[model samples]
Each structure stands twice: as structure tokens, then as C-alpha cells.
Target: MDIESQNSPQFFSWDSLPEQLKSILPLRHSYLIKNFNVLSPFQTTENFEIPQFELDAFVDIDDKEKAREWFLSFESKSKTTMPESRRYEIKGKKVLFREKRHCIHSKLVKEKQGNRELKRPQSSRLRNTNCAATIHLRLELCNIELSHPLEVNLRFTHNHVVNSAESLSFRRVNGEIRGKFLELFKDGHSPASAMYDYEDALYLSATDEQELLVLLADRATDPDYDYIAKLFHKYREMALGDRNGTSMFKRLEEVVNDYNNSGHGKAILQEYDSRTGKAFILCVVTNLMNRVHERVLQSGELCYMDASASFEPLNTSITLLYTSCMVGALPLGLFITSDESEITLEKA
Candidate 1:
């Protein structure tokens, strides 16, 4: 942590730096002009549809909840701060909730400045697929905000067949898979690594090959790394807080945000260097771990503990408190310490 080591230029490869990489995807104006016709949002006085899909017509329904159910059916997620399946617009007495589902393989939206495309040196997350497959819901509010007739627009004419292999991108991830992925990611694993580890973990946890296949049946046709990688980054920012923060205490603070409390929850034990106020001996035990350890103790099972030094490149020692299970050793507590001293060992 010295100034000389920090300022060293030999720490990384030249090609791996942010400046060396191609930052932005250049607008494919030629392909856009040739393959598609529509670009800007323009409507005529005759065609007064909400989403303005050319071939689709709006359906009328009386119930507002049914309109919401229609929105959720598409698995349409929110691109804005609004929750999924909850986008709406209010005009006078008319209360409108629109659900627009775009084709996954649809053409990319352009970033235009005036008439020309706005080409930037940096990367952008702004997306407009220009896909026609969509739905729009419109409803009117009577006096005292009473229920009125609802209008549902249909443009489910996706460019690709729904059951086709290319359309697999449209499949929604179930809560189980999403929760597991988030858990692994929050435990300091990369997207690719976490995926691989998850598969291995599943395989190891299952009783046999048959059981493994049964567990992985739903995930057999799951979207690959390319699609999940984008979701991973988004989940990291929203679920897990800023991963690039310089403060170690801030990270510990984030960890203890929910997982740890004075009352029976995840516990964090630490030994800090008085000079720098930096935690050198850090041990974390989750609620699950506490429950497992308690079970082991209650069952009068022989528990095992071990300390391994310098297994990682972080110049720290790892202390593991585990018990043998049917499949493998179940880790009850994990500790990362600067040294394998008596104080650190006691804390672990």
C-alpha cells in the first residue's frame, strides 16, 4: 500500500486498459437504412394508436387487473425506475398502462443528434430494439376514480418464431435460478466462474447423475453466458452495492446491512491494526452456518477445524470451521486473517 507500488505502470497489460479497448459500438446506419424503414417516432392524425405498431389492433376489456395480468404474461421488465408490469400514463380522465414487448433479435436503436447519429467515444447503455412485437393497455377513469373499459393493444408478431432456437432469449429466468446466481455473485464470484461453480455445486450436491439431470432439467435450455452476463452486471449494481469502493469498512458495512445483526443472524468478527485502522483478521459466519453448527453440536457430531495460510494471493490465511456431511464438508464458518496467530485463531 505504498505510493511507489501504487504508481507502478508494470502492474497491468497495455491491451487490458480501458483506454485501449473499443469503447462504443458504431451505429450501423447502412444496415438500418437497408433492412428497416422506421426510425423516428411519428404518428398521423388518422392512426391514433398508443404504441403505434402498424399491423396490430387494440382489444377492449372492462377489468384493470386483467390488463395488468396481460402485461405480466409477456414477462416484460421495466427499463426505467418503474417496477416491471407497472408502467402507466395519465391523461385527464384516461388512465393508461402500456406493456410493450420487443423482439430479442430486433435491430438496435440509433442515438441521433439532430438528423445525424450521435457517435460517442464512450460506451452507452441506452437501447431501443425497434421491434414491432408489443402490447399497450388503455383504461378510462370515471367520476370518483371508478373502473372503466380497458383497451389492450396487440403486436405479438415477433420477427422470429416464438418456439424457435433464436427466440430462446425471450424465456424468463425463474426466481430460484435468479436467487442462486445472485448469492454466488455476492460471494465474490465472476459471472462465468459463478456459473461453472454453480453447475459443479449442483452436480456434487445431487445423489447421482439421474438426480443431477432432474435438478438441471429446467435449466437445460436456459440462455447462455452472453445474455446472463448483462443481467449479472445489472444485478450487481441493484442487489449488491458498489463493488469498486475503496473503503474496507464500507464493504463490511454493506455486508452487515442485512446478513448480520446482534440478534441471531450472520456475525462478523474482526481484528484491526491500530495504526491504520485496517481489519487484518476478518471472520464471517452466516445464519445458515450458525444453524448448521448448532445442529452438529446438538447431534453430538465430531466437528473439524483447519487453518490454511497463503492459499490465495492476498497474503492472508484462511480458517475454515466445517463438519462432514453426506456429500462433502459443510463450511460452518470462514475466516480471512493476515496471520495464523493465537489472537486470529481465537477470533476464528
Candidate 2:
């Protein structure tokens, strides 16, 4: 019998799969498998169990190559010539770079008296194997249809649809993002002290645009909970130095700058600095307030009050704080002092 002919798709079925996969075939093949399992033994398996071989119920193609070939044969969908490899067939597949190299070998050691003895072991052969063992299967394309028609081709600055959709799908859970960064600047915590963990968290979470936005939004706001805000104020006040010396604004600027220069925060820093950003920071704070309140309500902590009423105070506070910074700073030409203008401490 010819080897090529022996390997043909015909005369091959689930029965022909490897033993490991063949064990799973009965469960897959039984039409009543779902209902059968529902009549529970009241037990759950910890590991996933897949049949050794399964017929391609959705697609007619058996082999990955055949699937690739079918996609390649399609007429040029565009004016441009299509490449030999088609995207749909190859999108998530990984081709082996080279044959496996033997790096580590397990050895059995037997100790007799003071000396040790090494032994080679024998292995059992697999029997009644099925096609599932030999053939690696792929996930069927998800046949998802949008409930609402997407007008993706529209010309708009920043493309609202794309941005909105991405924001919905990819936005980080607000509490998680806040808790992570707060872990760094935590009471008495500085980047210098927590540099190792800070670098790791920054690299891991901040790389994605949505995550970057989340962290930036988190740091760019004052704490929301009344208690937390009071605590933050207390800490800041305690850290503040005596009159004529230390400024919290300068210190905050340095800390925020440090956060921005590291990993993903750099992009956020650039975007915020390039644009009129106070409003964006306000919006982020609003997002946090709404998100946290929703979570609290879900957990039965607080009844959902009017979000608008809750947000107004924060908005006012943010504006007042920003205004204080702006109002206090003296322009170069407005005031000049070379230890010339001085105010004496009034002993009250």
C-alpha cells in the first residue's frame, strides 16, 4: 500500500485518531451528550476534556493547508493581488519555527548504600487512537452580527464611533486602576521606595491605551470618598513645610511628572500636555465618581443618589483648586524680587 494513499482523508475517521484524543470522541459523537451530562452525577471535572477526533461540523475543510488553499483560490477581492497566504486562514495560527530540541531529560535515580544508580525506563504504547490526536483543530469563526448597523466609513475627527466603541470595550475597571496607582503613592509611599513593583505595574498595566488613560485619569483626580479625600488632605498638610519654604503644588508636579515619564504614562503625559486638559481631568474624575457609586450601589453600600448632585461639588472643588494655582503664580514681568520684597511674620 502506498504511504500517500494510506494517509488519504478517506478510510479515516474518529476511529483512526490517537488514543489520547480517541477517549474523548464518544462524548463528542453522542447526539444526546448535552442532555446526558445534564442528568448529573453531581460532579465537575477540573480539567477540560476534548475528544480525540471530531468531524468538522461547521467547515468542510479537514486540514489547515486545505483551508488555506480554499481561501487562496478566491478571486482577488480588491484591485491589489492577494498574497499566497490568506489572512482568514492564518490569523491566529502559529507555525513551528523548527523541530523540537531536546534540552532537559528526566532521569530516575536509585540509591544503593552510599552510591546512587541511574536507570532508563520503558514506556507503554498507545492503542485504539483516533483522528483527534493527530489533527489539531481550530476555533470556528464567531458568527457575530452587530445589533445596530455600524457606519464606520464616516469622516470625522477622532472617528467618534471607533473611539466610543473601543472606550466601551476596553476601559479598565476604575477601582482597579486607582487601587494600583494608589499602591505606589500610598501613605508615605514614594516611587523611589517602591521602584521595583512600580516599574512592573507600570509596564504591565499602562502599556495599553485604555489602561494608560485609566491610570492617568486615576492620578489626575482628587480622591472621591469624603473620608478618603479628608485623609489625602491630612497627608498633604502634614507633608507641607513651614511658611516661605515647601510647596505641595511643586511636589505634586514632580510626582506626577515622574509617573508620566515612566512606561505607558509618557503617552498620557504627552496627550494631556498637548491639549487643553483640565476639562479632560475633570471628566475622568466624573467617570470615577459615577463608576465607584455604581459599584457601591451594586454592593448595597449606598443608595444611588442623583449623580449630577454628587458630581457638582467635585467639579467646583477641582475648579477652585486649579484657580488657586493659577491665581497664586506671579508672572515674570508682573513681579520681580531679589530678596527685595519681603513680608515679616506677624506675631498674632
Candidate 3:
């Protein structure tokens, strides 16, 4: 390896030449020697010239890690010495796509006898009409903290019923957060205690970039974080408490079943990468129940609790979601409902 070749101008990006040269100097001389000069002593000029001999000295440094380290070291020094504007380029976030829809609640009223106006309660009407929803989610990576950890925040709003056809209505829900850190750790086989740093935890546990974003969204904005975290703790403790307990067995089966049915638990467990590495997932599937019912008997105090709870708490243990651009199964990207949003990361 010729030292001269390592300094070539041809191989340097416009910004790299100065930084690269800084790395070659002895640490003590580069930092401590205030008045020392490599060329002429006691001569100072604000402007610096690129040396012809060093122009062709740039060599291929194939190790990206080493290059990054050198670049960062130079950057740190520049931050202190250079003016603020020239220190670094701040990457601006560009909106990828935005879909907006208006939601208006409609009363489910049977044709009244004659042309008299019929009255109905909004709450009861809300429960009676079978709502089919297509939630639009706005996603933006507003800020990214390099090295230490990535912080993501999601701000959302909603419109009521967009379209209602027959028994189904299409609309978006804007205020629910569906994922948690515990899920990320458990599904990725990482201990919850290992999550001291959010960014590193993400890099270690999330295989796909989308999943990473989803996980961050879950951590930062999901309102149900505490509830989910509690559930995870209880679930984990129960499993460890009795390996063959009846409750454990039932829970495991439910997790597995949920995964097969594209349920919330399973959605959180799937991951994919579009271009880089194979991804693992920790999906936060929400709005687990959607019902379509006929108006049967009229009652003032009917207990409308989950009629389908019997088939609930699905098995989501071995579930995974794959990303496909063409005609494929499974919902892609982010989907929001009138009450909640589900963020899933697929590694491509």
C-alpha cells in the first residue's frame, strides 16, 4: 500500500479530501501543536491549496467502517471549528404519499311508515351499522438520530365514514397506536432488558426498515404502550411460571392460531426487507374484530359485548407478513381505522 496513493484527489469526493488528510496526521500534532506547520514555518494564509503530489495519492479504502470512522472524527472537529452552515447537510424529509378521506356517520334507519321523520340515537346507530373501513395513514420519518438510536413520532387525524355500500362502510380511524417495545423484544428473541437504547434495540431486533419505523412508532406514539407492556410481562411470566400450565398451553395455541389468520399478534411477528437483509418482525396488529350483523330484535339494554370472543386471543406465534408489489395476499404498507392504526415493517 503506497501512502502517496492513499492521498489521491481522483478518488476523493469533494468533501472527503480535507477530512481524509486530517486522519493521517499524528493525533498530538493535529490537536496539540498550535503553531507547527508541515511546510513553511511562521507563514499563515487563510486560503489552502491542494497539493499536486497528493492529488493522485487517493487510494481505495475498501473498509466502509474505517471510512465512516474517519469521516465522523473529521466531522466532529469541523463542528467546533467551522461555521454552522458549512458543518453538515441536514436531510429534509419529503412526503412519499398522502391519502385523505372524509368520514360522516350515517343513521341506519328502516323505511318509516309514511313519510314521517324517524329518530335514532347516534351511539346505537354507530353500533348497528356494519362499518367497513379503509383507513389512510400519513407516515413521515421526521427525525432520525444517527448512531445512538432512532426516534420516531407519528401525528394522526381522522375523518368519519367515507363510503357506505350495502352492509359495509369504508372509513379511516385516526387515534390508535397498536405496537409496543416488549413485543419487539419478545418476538425478536431479544430480552426486554436489552432495550436500554432504542436505536440499537431496533437495529438488533428489526430486520426491515419498515418494521423499524413501525417499532419506533409503537414506542413513541402508541397510546396503548403501557397496556401492551403489562400484557407482555404477564404473558412472559406465565410462560416461565409453568411450562405446561393449562393457561400457557391455551395462550400458545391462541398465538399460533392468530398468526395463521393474519390477526394482530401474527401481524406484529412478520418482517421483510425489500432490498437489503432478511428481516424479522414485531407487528402490532390492532382493530382485531370487524363485524357485519343484521338488525334482529330491538332492545334498549342489549349487552353488545364481543359476541365473537370465543374465537379470540388468536395464535400469532409463528406468523409473518411478506411485501409484494403485484397481486399478492396480505395488506401492505400502513393501514389506519376510525379508531386505530396498525404499523407493520416488512424487510425487503
Candidate 4:
């Protein structure tokens, strides 16, 4: 993806940029200069050629903690200012923070599904801009005090105009708000009710979404109802234990442990494809499922399966193998798989 060789690279001296592009990076530098006795001219040396940007600016920070504080602010500000930026950890020492493209330029993905262009993404504010604006930080462990300053860099050219209002969907809802919504939901309040309940206990909007769906909102302010709905869906997935990802699987395992301890069900197979990480396979025969399965075997009753691809957060398909008898269609065993291929299912 690094087409820097084709972009006709342009380099501006760090000193020249303070006056030229100062408005582009409005806030971070003044804070750095005042606190860190900032280097007058950030030496750009060989320019640590990276394919990310047509233009790059480098700065040094002697104080690791302050630099971290600045980083925290910088990242938080992106939620409303440009796009919700995500950090891609490079090895363990550096991070490349870039804007997400919101799965916008996806024509190529249609041609190649393996490209994962439509996957869980960090969306960008504008599409096809290939916006070369980024902030790369050479980091040190924050847990302990470190002597050397981490190298910080930024890319200043944007092919499109940056606007805060365009990034409203990328706004992050705080954990407190999500937790409160979950509590209200668990108490049987609908998503709309949950939002109202949260607001009743906290901030009050003249209209239902007056405060939310704004250009910017603080922790005290609620997020758009869509975010709340997404959280509800996420909660269902976690409870179902069908979602993929290492963290999600670990949580599902906790649920499995609880199920086993309660003597309610036994998880015969709890497996994931570690190599490709594209599949989640689990087989569970609950007490009810087992009883129906045994009755079908003894009575030679009709057995059928229902397949559903609505399993969320991943492409896992759930197939319910059930037996029909006087008691009705009862599940014998649950089959969850990512592969819908004939050979794979036949093997299963």
C-alpha cells in the first residue's frame, strides 16, 4: 500500500512547518513546546521513510509521561474532530494511529472478499481520500519510568476537507453509559426506555435526542440510540457465547465454566480455528436436548435441522438439530460452524 515512490514526496523543514502548517495541527505542539522546552528544529534526518504519507513531520518529546498525556488527548479528540482513530501496534515499541475509512472504498472488496475490506473497521471521515494524515509514535512502556523520549511524527496533507460533524457515527459512547443502558435493559426496559432511564437519572435533553447526535458530547452526555442498540446486540452475542475473537471466546469459556458448575449443561466441544481465526465451532447438548435426542433414537421419530446465518459479530452459522415428537420440536444438539461448505458439513 505504500505508494510513496509514486506520490512525488515533498519534505518541509520542521522549522518551516511551525509557521506554515501550524493551523493544521492546532493544539499538540504548543503544549509540547511549553512543557518539554521543545526542540527548536526537529531534525528530520533520513526522514524514516514510511509509505503512509506524502508529507511527514517529526518531533521529539523528552518527557514520556507528558507525551503520553498528549497522546491520550490527541486520540480522544479525533473521535469528533476528524475520525475515530485506531492504533495499530507495530511490534511492541511503536504505534501507527490512522483514521478509519468506514468501509467506504469497497469496490475492490467486492472483487476479493479475502481483502476483508468490509470487516470490523476503523472508518475514515472521508472516502477514497486515501488521506495521508496520520500520527505515528515510537513508544516506550508506560508502566515504568523511561529516560529516552519517544519519537513522534505526523502527516499534514489531506486530500479532502476535515469536518467534525461528518464523524458523528464514529463517536465513542462511554463505558458508564453502556453499563447504565445494560442495567436498564436487564431490568426489562427497552432501548428507548433505557435511554430515557439513563437520561432521567442523569442529563436531561429537551428532545429525545437533543443532547445526543451532536457534534460532540462528553461522558455525561449520552450517545446516539444506534450505539445503544449495537450495545444491546453485543450483550446478546456475549450471552449466547457464539461470537468469535480471543477475548470473546474467553468470555464464552467463562459462561461455559458456569454452565458446567451449575450442572445444567456440558460443553462437549469448545473449539476455534486458531490459524485462520475465521471459525468458531461449538457443540453443546443441554439436558433438554439430550432427552429429546434419546427419545428420537428410541422412537425413530422425525429429526430435522434449521440453519440460520443471522449469528452476529461473525459469519458463524447456527444449525439446530432437533427431533419432532409429542413434546414438539426439541433440540438434540447445537451445531455452530463458520464453514457452510457441503464437504465441511458432511464431515461434521
Summing lDDT over every window of 10 consecutive residues in candidate 3, give the lowest-scoring window: 148-157
Best by lDDT: 4
TM-scores, in order shown? 0.40, 0.15, 0.16, 0.36
Q: Which 10 successive residues of model 4 have the least lDDT summed? A: 31-40
Q: Which candidate is the best by TM-score?
A: 1
- The Cα local distance difference test for each model comes to 0.48, 0.27, 0.30, 0.50
Q: For all the candidates, what are their Cα RMSDs to the real structure? A: 20.3, 23.5, 27.3, 15.3
- lDDT for each residue of candidate 3 in 58-108, tens digit (9 for 90 to 100): 112223344333333432332111111112222435432223221122121
Overall local distance difference test of candidate 4: 0.50
Residue 7 miss distance in model 3 (angstroms): 68
TM-score of 1: 0.40
lDDT of 1 by residue, 71-186 (tens): 44333221111122334455545554444444433442232222564444373422233445554456555411422244434343333333323233335555566778778777
Name model 1 segments beyond 4 Å from true.
1-66, 74-89, 98-104, 108-131, 142-148, 170-180, 183-268, 271-279, 283-315, 319-335, 338-348
TM value for model 3: 0.16
Q: 301, model 4: CA deviation in Å? A: 46
Better of 2 and 4 by lDDT: 4
Q: What clash pairs does model 4 have?
A: 100-122, 100-123, 100-124, 101-123, 101-124, 102-123, 102-124
